[model samples]
Target: MDIENMRAFITVAEHQSISHAAKELHQLQSNMTAKIKKIESEFNKELFYRKPRGMELNEEGKKLYAQFKKIVLLWEETRSMMNEDSPVLRLGLMVSKNPPNFDDAMKALYETYENLMVTIKTGSTPKIEEELVNGTIDIGFLVGKTDMNSLHYKKYGTEKLVLVGKNIDKPLEEILKHDNLIISSENCYYKKILDVLLEDHKAIRSDFVEIAALESMMNMCQLGMGVTLIPESDTARLGIRHYKVIDHSCCEIEKFISYRKNHKITGVEQQLMNRIVTAN
Candidate 1:
């Protein structure tokens, strides 16, 4: 079967509409329909149940979809290995104060392999997990452990969670009661820990601020606009002294490095992973 046909089958199965899949693939609806028909003809089986609403995959179609996805991924990986002189390592990272030391790792990788190329995508843990399963990234650095069976996880390091504010002299209860809660994002793991700490203290903040940039959040906290919870490494790096170490039950969080379980680890990729694991 053609690799393009396999990709088209996966897209149609995901969208359940040839028109939608065609638009996504920048192809005509007729072309998409013909590709599906060709696949079904080759298999001598009706893969889809044509409903008025949309095309739904049959049992055989579901099986083929799974296999085709793997085949497409393998084809891409093989092509990448054959076509490029330099090896490329795609990485996904969760936004955090103290992420893995990829800067040093990449520096070492580039020094060892002159033609090594590295790409990084940063987002929430869930986003990173999704991209990893989709085979967009080879490795992921994220907060906490993941229960994804398709991926394998390793303990990268641990971070000491701390609350940073201008008024470190004040009591925790007073700070929680009066100060605004400044967080990076709604899905941030540190924000969840802060939520639990607040519940434990039964303290309600006056307001909350969501800032995407770490520097901005820290500046806001320095100006007494709000208080934010971050890794103690961040405060030390920035030379911020007006912060208190969180003594709550969730004071520390583990960082993890994840990758797809079935992914074939290349020599360069393995070297980078070794450097990261050793450094951490």
Candidate 2:
């Protein structure tokens, strides 16, 4: 039996609705309906009784669902246990949270797969997207709008952006008139928001500096060089002053884990994905 079709059968049976099952599986309703139909044709049996409410499994479907559940469990266990040196998982990270918080997930991964190699690169969203398309990276974490139809993404969390400064004794209005701004590279999404905010405030700067690294940006702000926008969670321990944006729409960013839609997900990849999605 086709494993995907069997899996689809199980999902539909559990949900008792093809539309719900299709949404959960990230597949179109028509595609999911076709898969179920194909499975029924293969077995030469009607697995579900069509109804106005939804699909209800017939006797044969109940029997096959029970067996398929065990089969899926066994296959997952086997795949998890098959340990060997796997290809490198090239990951791209865009945000910087100090005291690196992914230790537990990394430890769990190493324990589960002893020989798999992992590499991490940090860059802007556009830069990482280019790398992903060129096969230089396998997966990436991005913040902001993701409109690439050729890629797949799961939104895991949200980060709040705030204007952070060091030892500023002046009001926000006075600070806006300083004409000095610190931010990331030109391609950064945060930088774009900062530009819009500056324009709205009529505080166009002739002294805006582009610092590529998050640590460096914070350091520059600490030295009273200029104010910068940073993720709110990252400013807790830095003893910095952060202000909520006057326009609240640009302050919240949706965090996503993105990968190529056509790439096959392996057991290891799925485990790592689960850990990341859960941890965040």
Q: Identify the candidate with maximal TM-score.
A: 2
Q: Return the clash pairs for model 1, or none.
A: none
For residues 34-53, what per-residue lDDT tens digits would candidate 2 score against the true structure?
A: 99999889889999989999
RMSD of each: 13.4, 7.4
Per-residue CA lDDT of candidate 1, range 1-280, in tens? 9998997998788778898888656699999999999999999999999999899999999999879866765665456456658888898877754355668767766765567677788887878898999998998888875579898776657888888878767888877777888887887777778778888889765356889998898888898888888777777687887678867768888877788888876656655654565466
Candidate number with greatest lDDT: 1
Clashes of 2: 0
Q: In model 1, how large is the Cα lDDT of residue 59?
A: 100
Worst 10-residue lDDT window, candidate 1: 270-279
Candidate 2 error regions (>4 Å): 1-26, 30-80, 83-87, 95-101, 167-173, 237-247
- Every model's TM-score: 0.66, 0.69
C-alpha RMSD of candidate 2 = 7.4
Candidate 2 residue pairs in backbone clash: none
After best superposition, candidate 2 residue 49: deviation in angstroms?
25
